[model samples]
Target: MKAALVGADGALLYEVRRATGRERGPDAVVEGILGFAAELRAYGAEHFGESALAAGVAVPGIVDAENGIAVYAANLGWRDVPMRALLAERLGGVPVALGHDVRTGGLAEGRLGAGRGADRFMFIPLGTGIAGAIGIGGTIEAGAHGYAGEIGHVVVRPDGPECGCRQRGCLETLASAAAVSRAWAAASGDPEADAADCAKAVESGDPEAVRVWLDAVDALAAGLVTALTLLDPRTLIIGGGLAEAGETLFTPLRAAVEERVTFQKLPEIVPAALGDTAGCLGAGLLAWDLVAPADGPAAVTGSGAP
Candidate 1:
């Protein structure tokens, strides 16, 4: 878990990371988040001499943001944890906003980064797990049940691979960073090989790497074309560790997408401008929103870039 103390101006004041402690059990993970939130609040007051008006926390899982409940998190092993209320109580009634991690990162990207000017955009992060954040206007669509942008569950290859979600040929199973890493590692006989290593090998003219990379790219393109056919987003913003491969991923991805499109408008497929700090910055934005009135003065940085 990562926490950042962001000022009213959306500037990052302090940051820290802690283990989720899942091995210790779900309660331990919840406590870790709550304790870190309290610690961050205390640190802000003591060091900056400013009492934080509100706090925003982004969590991974099926989150009910409206009710501030973490509905379920398979990795964290928790269900129906009232994270927002707990944080509010621990922080002495400080207002809190709960958000999904991927959605929050997409918020930052839409407001301040890659999708800045686009009316409608999709933030697809091809990471350890693939997920999407659908951005419309200034906010994201969390859906009626807060499970809107689960692009990873989209099946691209019915006979490909099994996903942790218990589905075959899901996008994550075939094209996610973790999937690519595992495939490359298995093919190259390197236990430590990751998606980046696969990219490097492909650049070095390794046939196995090329095959693995192309397979992932093909599946990714199929999934993306499906999303475009449904969402018709003006821009498709790709982020996460895999995107760090730069043109090695984008060039072929664009071509594959182009080949698949028939009547749909081709949206710009761009890399996310914010790197790892997107979710942290997004949390800061949510915090600012809770404190600032609708008609009141806005934060110094409207976009919350940092």
Candidate 2:
């Protein structure tokens, strides 16, 4: 888990990182987050002469953001956890906002990063798992059930591979960082090889590495093109580990997207400028929004559902 003590101006005055300690069990992890949040609130009160006006938390998984319910996080083994109420009780009545991790990051990108000027944008992170956040104005459209931007589950290749969502041929199965790592490691006969290693091999003109890399790129392009057709976003912000390959990933991915475009207006695909700080900044925005609504698209809140 990561957090920050952000001022009203959205600047982080102090920051912290902690392990979720999933090995200690899901309940323990949840409790740990609650305690850490409460501590941060107290710290701000002690040092700044005031407590935090509001707090925002972003988490991974299928979240029911509006009600502050962490619906289910497969990796953390969480289901129906009442994060907002728990944290609020601990923080002594401070208002709290809950959000999806990816959407929160997108909020930051749209408001302050690569998508700053685009009213409609999409932030897609090709990380361990693929996920997306659609930014309209400065807020992410969380959908009626807080399940919008689930493009990773879009079936781009019906016969491709099975996803953890128990669906066949989902986009993430073929294009995510984990998928690339798995494929490259298998193809290169190195059990420990990761996506970064694949990129290095591709740079060195390894045929197998090039083939594997191209396959993932092509799959990603398909998913992106489909998204463009549906949303017609003015900007598409790509982030996460695979993007670290820089031109190696962008040049070909751009070309592939060009090849597939027929009638859609091509969005300016750019790498996320905020790096790892996007989510933290977004959480701060949401917290500020809670204290002052009617303010410019304050960070996407648990109330941002749909």
Candidate 3:
């Protein structure tokens, strides 16, 4: 879990990381987050001479942001957890904000990172699974049902591997980091081969790795084209594990997207600038939003003294 004490101008006054201890069960994971947050609040009071005005947490899975509930997260084994209320109560009734992880990260990216000036942007992270965050104006849209930018589930291949969303040919089934890892492991005859290794092999001009990489790129481009056709974002930010390949992913991705575009204005594609801390910084923004002027900028920089 990532936690922080953020200043009104979005400075990360303090930060810490710890294991979620999921093996101890979902309940324990919640307890861990609560305990970690309490510690952060206490530390902020001691070091900065005041308790945090508000707190924000970015979590994975389906979140009912309006109600502050973590509705479901398959990986974390969470369901219907009233995260905001719990955190608020734990931290002596301070206001608490709960956000979807990808959306929260996209908020940081849009307001302070790669998509800073884009009025409309999309943030897609190619991790174990693929998900997206839609940024419009200054806020991330939660959609009518809080499932707005789920581009990964878009079907790009009619006959492909199944996805955890119970759909075959889903974009993530063919294009996510997990999918590339699986393909590379099979092609290289190395069960432990991962997407990072696949990227190295691609750099080395390995035919199998090239094939696997291109296939994933193709699927991703197809899904992205579909999304762009509808959203018409000004910038498309690619992030997560697969994006660590740098140009290996972007060069071909750009080409594939260009080949497919017709009437849609192609958005400038860029790597996520904030890296892994986007989520934490975004959470800080959320907290700041509760206290700062609605028209004010996040004005945050992680370079502050710890």
Winner by lDDT: 3
Q: lDDT for model 1, please.
A: 0.88
TM-score: the better of candidates 1 and 3: 3
Ranking by TM-score: 3, 2, 1
Tell me the spans in candidate 2 whose CA falls farther than 4 Å from its real position: 295-306
Candidate 1 Cα outliers beyond 4 Å, as residue runs: 293-306
| Clash count of each predicted structure | 0, 2, 0
TM-score of each: 0.93, 0.95, 0.96
Clashing pairs in 2: 285-299, 286-299
Question: Model 3 off-target regions past 4 Å?
Answer: 293-306
Candidate 3 residue pairs in clash (backbone atoms < 3 Å): none
lDDT per residue (tens digit) for residues 242-291 in model 2: 99899999999999999999999999999998888888888877777787
Report lDDT (Cα) of residue 85, candidate 1: 90
* Poorest 10 consecutive residues by lDDT, candidate 1: 295-304
Better lDDT candidate (1, 3): 3
Model 3: per-residue lDDT, tens digit, 1-306? 888776655556677898999999999999999999999888988998777888889999999998999999998999999999999999999888889999999999998899998999999999988899999998998899999999999989878887778888999889999999999999999999999999999999999899999999999999999999999999999999999999999999999999999999999999999989999989988877776636324443333322
TM-score of 3: 0.96
